[model samples]
Target: MIEFECIQCGTSLRVENRHAGRTAWCRRCKRPVLVPVNATPIADQPDEFPTPVPPAQPVARPYFEPSQPPALEEPQETAMPAPVKRGPIQAMDTDPRNAALLAEIERRGRVIAQLTAEVEALRQAAESRAREGDLLEAELAAARKMALSGVQDTGRERAMIEELNAIISTQRELLVEKDEKIYKLDAALRRATRYSAETDGNTELPDVPRTLEDQTEAGGYEEGAEGGDARANVELDEARRLAQHRSLEIRSLRNALDDMAAKFDRVTVELRNAVLKLTETQQDNERLVSELASARDRLREKEFEGERFSTEPAQAPAESMEPALLEESLSSPVQVEVRPEPVWATAPVPRPEPVRAYSPPVTTPASDMPAQPATDIQHDQRVLVDALLRFLGRR
Candidate 1:
């Protein structure tokens, strides 16, 4: 037997002298160690075997388990143990077969040691990934919470918008109703003016025609002219009174329209502000949604990598690691309940129509009948109508 200690782990190992000058793995550290040749003379050997085979490969040795537990700390690369030298090989019959066998054993030992190290590295990587997965799960939970809150906020905003829309529709209806009433009032006023003109025409029309046909002399003409002057004065007074009443009504209607317009403008401004707020909330909601999706995708990728790295039975099961929670969060839909808003067109406020004064036509029996009074009456009527038209236009 050849006795030697491992250079890396300092473990004592005993191998058959047939394995001399061969490399083997350390049972404790799993690193390759060179077995030194026996220094004792061949006469001291107890048993000898006949070696006749030239190309037969050496049999692989069975692996031995360590008596003690593996060390908790990993070996550092920068701090390697010094080599332990053993005595050189003793003089023997020079043979090519022994050299070839030793070389083969050494090569096999190196390959096994490299594979073992690779597996250890993979195991360490899997453990580190498991810890990262736990942190990702916590973050996913937080993101889910935030998304829930955003959904709730969006719901509230939609409700408020619905209420505003309802109010706007009602206001629109009220405006339409008011417009119809104003139009009806305008039509009624026009009918009343027409009827009054017709009545005045009926009253004054017969007198002028009768006077023109029956009067035959200058004395009859003078008496007719005097009577015409009195009638003209009465008509002027009636026209003035009617004008004042119509002016008051028009003024009141104009004030009402002004107030309604002011209210409508205020409502429009409020609607604009509400729309802007809704837009901002929607943008924020979209941003949050994108963030959630990205996070979900990242988590999925991490899960895939984790699955690939961890194949050991000793590692925790994927199901026990809260995959359901992640799936639930990712799969759950955020619903935004929406109710259709009524679109109501705003009606323009009705403006009061311009008032026109009506006058009956008058005729004189003779050319000698004084024409100055008739001309003055027509001029006064024209002035009053013009003033009323200006007032209504200004309003």
Candidate 2:
């Protein structure tokens, strides 16, 4: 006999007949079973065969050789079945297990709903972040364009700074040269002033009578003759006084010129020093500006590196690891102190004293005589008077 077992539950089915082909059902589980023929027996039990039943007789039909016409039958229409009605949901007034399972299902449904909401929120956040990233990318592109423009500007500025420095250096050199020139000019002016003073003092002397006896003897003539001589003598004295006054005026002028020259020399020296100090100030300014530019460049580089690190996720480690140290290092302000150059007070150049114009009196024969001489003295006196008058007029 062939044995068959249920595949799902592993239950054996019993067969009543042992035939070539037999079909049966399992008694434990109400399912159909089929037995295979030519089966092996278990535990030495012989295979049993069932007795065959009699066959049913078939009725005989008359044979005809004629062609028949087929008749068409009317098609029957089947009624459509109604949809099945569902019963109302039962309330939770029954078993605790059912209530618990329903509650668990409801809880799981709520949890699923919450999870779905969280997923939607996360998706929205991701979308927002993507939009923000797009905006940031546009801004970054604009910033990069601006940065390139700034670099060009920086080059221009650097060139300008270099040009300015060159100009300042040239100016400083010119200032030094000017100072030297001023010093030389001052020395030359001082020497010229001293020479002028000496020349003015030694140039000429006034023509004055040498002896008082000449005046007394010339006064001893008759009233009418002495009157004319006395008038002439008075005129000569007035001429001498006028000449002395001129000499005094020339001495005053020389003194004034010397004083002016001395003042000019002192002024020139001061001006030269002022120019030098100004040049130094300009140089200092250039140096400070260069230092400031270097500091700013370093600051810009630091900012660029910081921005680059901030923008890239992979570079975030560098930002986080030493931000304080970097900030502390970068944020310190550079102090540049420019000390003012000292300006020394220049002393006044002393003017040389005015030189007096003096000359030794020369004795004449007429001025030395005690009595009048008789050798055409009137003609000689007339000649002398004419010469004196001419000299006074020329002066």
Candidate 3:
């Protein structure tokens, strides 16, 4: 440390050796001063004045004022008062009160610096929390999107299930039909075997008929008995094959339905978990928001306290004048302008009548009358009777 005195203000200054021969501004007077290459020790300097120097000591006392002391005393005293009056403008090294004031100012400065740091930390925390909230919100939106997709998937699965159920029902009906056909074929086969046993020495079975009607026709009776047996056997084989194929299809469809149900259940569970996470995130965001609000309130309170402390000395004179200003303001009467309500505001408004729906005018059909007046009367009576009967029947 290089200790030096500022020539401009005689303020004590300390700087590092690295700044030797460099020009720097004085902290006290804000004037540029050159830093010495070598450190200046306080002990080496002459004690030209007291360590706790008072600013307003006399420059010099008149040496020839021994005689006529009372006459010169008045002039000397008058001149000394000017420097005394300017005492507060100089350094405050002597007064205990000024020292206390300096200490308080320094303490307040430290407090302000600490508060600033705390506010910065709080701001950073709030910013981080806000970012976290945004991320959570985005996550929540993604969850909602996923949930919507899951719901759509579930609906699709339900529709698929319904289609499968319809298919299964149709298959059941087809199976019942096949069962009836098989029963009829077995009965026909039984009858054929009985006939064949009775006619064992007769002609062998012929080519299969396409339909029962073909075999039952009178012209086809010669070939009927043998052809009917062959046709029943062919139809029974076809029915059994179709039933087996249908059963395989139904089994595959059931497996597909079970797989879809499992997927639906898994999706449902995922959606539920997402909803729970969304709720928890919302709660955390709300808590952070409340904490941020409280922090803002505390920061505002701290700012207000700082402002009050800073303004206390300035407000002293204003507070002293408050009573006078209040009394003066009270002595005067304030004028206010009053406006009357508009005629529209006080008057009742007329309500419009409700409009009715338009109806088309009804026209009576022209009467069909004979040129003879007696015939016209009979025709009108008949028309009236028919109209009355129709209306009564409708009722």
Candidate 4:
């Protein structure tokens, strides 16, 4: 880039290095002047006269702004003034002052022409800048207004996040309380098992032959252990019955506890995921709010700039403002891609197991007790499982 003073009015003008030794109009004086190969504009030097009066600028600018004007080459050096040819008497009659006056008139005319061209350039540039400023202001206003309307959406998002947080907290509390209850129930089950085992151990050995008829009569039934096999003991059969009942009860309780525990775990995991989603939604809302604020600020600043440009013509130069406006584009905030959080159904907790009353131990000798058939034991287990399944189905 190069900068130089216009000799006619002392207005500092700037140009690219390619414009050196070429003629361009002085923005202040409207006179043609030459740019130097290496020069600097003195910012402190004021123009000798006010800028030339501008004619109305071209209103129909193309969609794309035009490039910089071509430089005006030095016309004086290439086309030298022609020599006057006069006859001897006529030349003598011509006044010397008249010749000087004619030359002055020609110089003034060139100056007037240069001033007119410079004025036109300034006018065109000013109009373009004004139009661009108006467009920018419009864009900024529309963008800001759009973002402002989303304030309600942002508030709703925030409220939903808070609501989710509250729900998650309550669920966590319920889970903790339920876990405590489960722990207590487990401890009670263990104690019950130990008590049942101790009661079984304290029983005395039974005399099966003597007590067989008596025990069968006491129960109001006269069935043998294995349907008339003499070796099948009646006392042993009674003990096996009690053991089967206890085993079934224990199995049902354990299964129910396990199912409940698993459900709790699944519920906890789902609640945690919900919390994560809520946190993400909160972050998005915050970002959206920030964007809205910035857009509003930008709109206000642009509105001020537009007002100042429209009102003050002295500060806006046709040449300087054109390049600046060409580089600038209207800015607006882009909204983030937001989505609603989803709710999922979780696994259900099983109902509590029903408690069974403890049975009294039967008096029988372990060495002499008859072994129950595997098939009978399996059949009893299946019946217990079926009962428990039915109970669960109702719930």
Candidate 5:
């Protein structure tokens, strides 16, 4: 017999032997399915009398029974099998396999213990390494940050340097302008000096020609006739006067030129010195600025070093002993004297005397006293007495 089921509905199907190798439809679902030759038919007959179904109950059972009072059946004794002859018993210590096994177990245990210790050590080492790595990472981050800060600071410093350089360049340009102005002024003064010198030299040349011209003009007769010689002398005098006036004007002009040249030279020298001093001052200022920056850098380095020193951990107690040892090795003892002395050893100082103010004595007026006759007094005596009286009165 063969079993057949509907593919779609999973329903059992039965077919006659003659209907083998034929297609059929499910009776329940009406699904087409193939019928096999060996299909078994499910029985559908009902029992004539039905048996009562038992009610569900809990099964009560015990794993083990209690001891029995006695056995009801006689126990039968079967023949025991004869013991087989065997080799002499071997001592556990003499068993190489067991010993080897135990040794191997011990070795394995030791290996396991070592491995466990190593694992624990590795764990601690890993933890330490991790901590170290974390610290290093933090340090690296800090260093990176510091480096970036340094780079920024460097950029700022570079900018500051550029600004300073620009300022210096501007100052230099100003100095160059000042120098140019000074040079121009000096050249001007030099030209003025040469001009004044030439003028002075020409002035000193002589009043000889002017004096001769005046003498000749004075000796010559004038055109208007009066007393001829007298008129001529008068006209000549006037001409000599005119010639003197002209000479005086020339002298004045020469003096004026000399004075102007002196003034120019003086001003030029002063300006030149001033320019030199200004340049010196500027150089000094730059030197001072450099010194100030160096001092600040040193101060910052010292502060950083101090911070590092303060942040470092203290030395161990054993390490601290070296200072004591050094102290002992280098120690020296010296006797100190104990002296007793009077607390008031020095003499008392003398006090200064008070100053006294002078008071002037009062004098009665001369009018209140008797006056001597003026007739009795000689002229010389009167002058002397008046002088003496005036001196005394003033005093």
Candidate 6:
């Protein structure tokens, strides 16, 4: 028997020598291969110990029809080969074709492993890129929202500025109107003060003259204290200017009224001094009227003396006339002359002085006038003159 290895699979086999150098299929690998002719058969060796090999059993081939294996023929055992010249020839290396097949298998295995590792790395890269894309989308959405909010805030600020401008303009107009009102009030107050002062000094209102000049100076202090001190300082300056203007006007009016009253008192004093001169002129006129009445009384006495002379001659009876004629008298008109003195032309005017009257004539018809009657007449003349003087003074 000869023993050999299957070139494709390395499985051991025992075969007859006739099968050497033949092409056959390996039972385990199922691939066709050539057997080497230079191989040493195991049965050809001489051994110090001989071991028997089991017989090979027949195997069925699924690819062919059933057939019987060839029977082995008996042969004499062979002797061992002579000693080798260089040592026993080393066993030949495996078949070149078989070695080539084994190398190709190893190369294929390495290629499969490398391809698997590359596929795993590519899968991890894809997952990382997807996560990054999701994060970028969220950031873009936030930026858009912020831009919209900024635009809304800008529009609101514009509207607020416009409202403030309108309010400021209205305040300016109100200030102008207020200034006009203040000017009108000041002018009216000044006119009233001046007119009152020009009128009769006693006829002015008691409090109004004082208040118009001073109220602005004295009032508003309470309001200033209630408000803040900073604002009060500004208003106080304006109040001071107004008070000064009013005070000056009031002072001028008061001075004018005092001068007019003083001049009127002086004129009244001069008129009172003229009264003594007027009393003397009235006494001289009364004396002239009393002398005229006495002359009329003397003319009656002269007429009675003439009548007695004529009646005594007629009683002698030489120049006899009718006795009835003695009781009658011739009718004749008598002339009396009166001399008049103008009292006003000759009267002397002098400053006020003392006066005294010594005697006064009486015009009443009596045989003799009593001193009591003349005294009464003089007293009555003095009373009449005083009444007339008083009436003139009043006028």
Question: Which numbered prediction scores highest in TM-score against the true structure?
Answer: 3
Higher TM-score: candidate 1 or 3? Answer: 3
lDDT of 1 at 87: 34
Q: State how far residue 229 of model 1 sits from its true place (Å).
A: 20
Q: What local lDDT does model 2 show for residue 97?
A: 29
Per-residue CA lDDT of candidate 3, range 325-361, in tens? Answer: 4354335343211233233222221111111111222
Q: Local distance difference test, per candidate?
A: 0.49, 0.45, 0.50, 0.46, 0.45, 0.42
Clash pairs detected, candidate 2: none
Task: Judge candidate 6 at residue 131 and give its lDDT.
Answer: 41
lDDT of 4 at 11: 84
Ranking by lDDT: 3, 1, 4, 5, 2, 6
Candidate 2 weakest ten by summed lDDT = 344-353
Cα RMSD to native, each candidate?
A: 48.6, 54.7, 35.1, 44.9, 45.0, 87.3
Candidate 1 lDDT, 61-172, residue by residue in tens? 9999879977799867796789867433211114322343334334434433433343443334334334434544554455556556656665666666566566666656
TM-scores, all candidates, are 0.28, 0.27, 0.35, 0.29, 0.27, 0.23
lDDT digits (tens) for residues 304-348 of candidate 2: 543443333211112222445444433434221212211111111
Candidate 5 lDDT tens digits, 328-388: 3234232212122222111111111111111222222122234323221123223333433
Task: Pick the lDDT winner.
Answer: 3
For model 6, the stretches where C-alpha displacement exceeds 4 angstroms are 1-123, 187-395
| Alpha carbon deviation, residue 33, candidate 5 (Å) | 56
Question: Judged by lDDT against the true structure, how good is candidate 2?
Answer: 0.45
lDDT (10s digit) by residue, model 6, range 1-71 = 56678866799766667878887677899887676676667655456447689999999977977899899
Candidate 2 vs candidate 3: the lDDT winner is 3
Each prediction's number of clashing residue pairs = 0, 0, 0, 0, 4, 0
